[model samples]
Target: MALALALPAWASHPGQRELIAEVVRDTGQDPAALEALLDGAQKQPSILEAMARPAEAKPWSAYRPIFLTPQRIDEGVAFYRTHRALIEDTARRYGVDPAYLVAILGVETHYGRITGRYKVLDALVTLAFYYPPRAAYFRSELKTLLELPPDHLAGPLDALTGSYAGAQGWGQFMPSSIRDYAVDGDGDGRIDLKNSLPDILASVAHYFAGHGWVSGAPVAARAQPAADARAVPVADARPQWPLEQLQAWGYAPLVPLDPALPSSLQTLEGPHGPEYWFTFDNFYVITRYNKSPLYAMAVHQLAQAIAAGVGDAGP
Candidate 1:
């Protein structure tokens, strides 16, 4: 009865409500608390505004400046050194390679120094309740969150503690992904990604592995376009297209004799015409962390910068 009324706070979408109901039943959470959250969430305008400005919409030239600063590269290095053991162990365990993990951390939240200031409660609340375009998706995440394991006095809601988008902790696993992949790597029985270096490393490695990361392979390299490939339409400067598809368009191989591999052709507007690359499967693996080619590229470049012994790589 009361639970039926609370459904509106989640979303108008039928699927969203069902999932929420399932989680509430699964967790034994007071349906009333979810109602209260939805009641308060439906009133926040800031959350609505934030969703409209997906950072990926910016041009690659513009987005490039946001992350590829000399400072971020340096920080990526420092972070690598501090978490060396965990990173190495995770690489070995997941077969994902440590540099990729470090790069991902560097790009996602600047090594946790600035892991988005938004409270997870607020962002999820805003998106799930108000933003009809994506409410269904966010609401499902809320349900997944409520069903996370190790229920306690705190209940399953303790899963992720920050960001309204439901992406929290060091690597910012979305609620669903967090529940599915998070592991307590240090044997402490707590899968605390925010502060546990071991857990964060392992969780991230798990995530990449789940997304199909290839170990011991080049992510991408600077390349020129094939004469015939030059006219293919570039799609938002991302690494989504496969290599063969890109080659047909105009992107040439950067490494002369590396054989054919699946790749994406990115055309970021450079200072001159455009910066292009033939991205690989590993590059696609990075995008699973954040579904933006530019973001993954920034992280990859920063990781490379750190690995190359020419940058800061932070804590």
Candidate 2:
């Protein structure tokens, strides 16, 4: 028998009943509590509007300036410096580059300086119920939110705020990712990515390690396309072609690559026509963090800039 209580009456949507029933079944949460939670969630029109104009859809020229600014890079370096011991320890334990971890934090929330203000429950509920384009996906995330334990979060579920998409903390991990990959690096017996810098860094490294980040491998290199070179069809970020095959097709890297190394040709719309690069295995790993090639490239470039000591400005 499903638990029911005298919940106050509220306006309902088409799928709310089914989702509430499912969540109740899955989590054994009282249906009335679930109902009250959803009832309190307000649909935000801006969330729907923002979905149509994500930064990843922009050209490299426009997108690069947004994330690769001197301020962001400098802040990333400072974050790395402040957390050098923890970052290095986490990187050694996970075999992921510390720079990439720092870059992800930089790109996601400007080193925790801007981890969004919208309530996570509000964002998830609004998108799950109101956004039809990705309703199924957001609905699944909403389900995950219901299933998350209070202890696993930085704060209470209703108070937790993040990206409009409901991603949380310094790394902006979706709720599911938080449930699976978040860690308690501070040894306080709690995983709080929002305020615990060590936990956030470790969780970022843990996510990359879980996704197969190679410790010491080149991510990508500039490739010169021959005059006769034609862009190859790319289905996804996975490195599918061997270097020998790419070289034979006139898409050769500026630096020598292993003939046996698997690679992929990524075509980007740069300010100056089509730009191509021989993206390596590590680049593909970065894509698992974010499905967008643009996002992956931004992290890559930001990591490079920080590693090269270009970001000297104090935060």
Candidate 3:
């Protein structure tokens, strides 16, 4: 015989109380204050639905066209031109390509134009409690948000909005990312990634530099696979082999590169057939910003197009 479990009698979720207690103990915030704040945060079912089907879930064929559009490229170029001095300065300081930094913002929040409309508290609460897939991680971010200083936030705590996953501001930095990597680029004594372009640019550059952005290093190159070689495409972005070994395993770059450079053979399904590319350490660094290979590729391709002056024209 099968038995069903009975629901608890509390009006609020049992976990809410547990979470409040955990936060109070870990952060030393008053339990009453935490509970009062949490009482205002509503559970969002739509956020859970959105989390289930992220854009990264799409195939490379579908994902590429979404980000590498003519309109976005044109806008990215305009943004780069408008902030040329800041971009160049930040790039010089961080040892990252200016085009790449612009592309990160362009891909992330569209150069501060579309930084999401969901309340950060609502999104973080919904994901922290309701979403079991990444509840632990989101719960940690919730703690970080609670610990954020008022100076770093622009307006009221509840007024801030960002991505469904709780990333905020122009660069869509997570709570922990903001705490670790955010900088006061404008010299106003506060880091605001939402409205402050300097802060956003500096913060993005700092993030890339922290993750090992090899200045002037090649990101990726088209590789001609050997006819008889077995395909061993990498699913993750971490470079696992040196260039010479990848070449021996049937992946040869279209352009010449140092044999000692670290690389990995990456493959994606193109409209025509299986496409191969030799991704370098710099390409892997791009993936640190976003885990998917498609995301990194889109950013790389967009940066390349911008560097080549492809504005309002298709890459």
Candidate 4:
């Protein structure tokens, strides 16, 4: 006979009560109401499963095709054309490249066509209590969600839906990101990242600007390794070495780049063979949105494709 497992009641579950208390104590919200809200959140095992298998875990050869599809590039162009005025205006205000902004939306949620399906409360609760690895981070996010003002959220807490990690809207912003970077672009007052295009575009641009995205700066360039190329150590995506140093290390840019530019060497296993790249400060900024070098490259390439399709329509 199969054994039946008993599920813990959320209202009395270990850590759940403590999390509710923390939020209520921090925000001075009604304890009863907060308890009720948390009680309603069902722990989703699938959320923990999804978190363990993020797409970023894949190799560049496999990951590149996921976001840099021709279909995504074409739709990004259409999205830009459809919202040209708003995208341009937001980019100009934030001093970010318009194409990169479109590419972020394209890579994040397929231009908002597929935001997410899991309930935000459930996802957060599951991660906060069950996932020991990032529990503290998700616990803080849960606290933030509980403390958020009504105007900050698009709908009721129980009805809020987003990514498996509890990120919301088109850009997949966490609660902290929404609190910090989300904007009220439409001028009606509240920031609606789901239904409002202006708010979404401006929020993404604001995030990039907040993370120090330098306008008109090159993101990354293909590099040709010398026949006797010396191996360069790359700890992370941050540009800590000068281009001159990298060139001296046996990697030369395919296109001419300022030798004084701060750069980091990135090697990826491509379909053909090993691909080398000289990543710049702007590339680091893209990684601020997502730390994966593969993700940053996809956004950069997709942005280039979209910009090419849009012609010389300067922002």
Range of the 10 consecutive residues with the lowest summed lDDT in candidate 3: 1-10
lDDT (Cα, 0-100) at 253 in candidate 2 = 80
TM-score of each: 0.82, 0.93, 0.92, 0.95
Worst 10 residues of 2 by lDDT: 1-10
Q: Candidate 3's residue-wise lDDT over 1-315, tens digit each?
A: 122123212217777788777777777888887766766776778899999999999888888898899988889888888888898899899998889988998899887888998889888989888888899999889888888887777666778899888889989999899888898999999889898889999999999999999788889888898997666857697888888988888777887889998888778787788789888888998898888998999999989878767342221
Q: Model 1, 1-315: lDDT tens per residue?
A: 886685544445454456556768777776766555444433356667766787788877788778878888778777777877778888889987787787777777778876665656557766766678987888777666655664210123423355546687768788787777887778787787787878888888998888887788777777687656556564543446556666566556655635456556666766577887777777777876777888877878777788775343321
Error of 1 at 291 (Å): 1.6
The positional error of residue 61 in candidate 4, measured at the CA in angstroms, is 1.1
Q: Write the per-residue lDDT of candidate 4 for residues 30-95, one digit (tens) a residue.
A: 888887777778889899899989998988899999999989999999999998988888999999
Q: Candidate 2: where are CA atoms >4 Å away? A: 1-11, 310-315
Clashing pairs in 2: none
Maximum-lDDT candidate:
4
Candidates ranked, most accurate by TM-score first: 4, 2, 3, 1
Q: With candidate 3 superimposed using the best TM-score fit, by how many Å does residue 134's alpha carbon deviate from the native? A: 0.9
Q: All candidates' lDDT scores?
A: 0.69, 0.84, 0.84, 0.89
Which candidate wins on TM-score? 4
Local distance difference test, candidate 1? 0.69
- Greater TM-score among 1 and 3 belongs to 3
Superposed Cα deviation of residue 206, candidate 4 (Å): 0.5
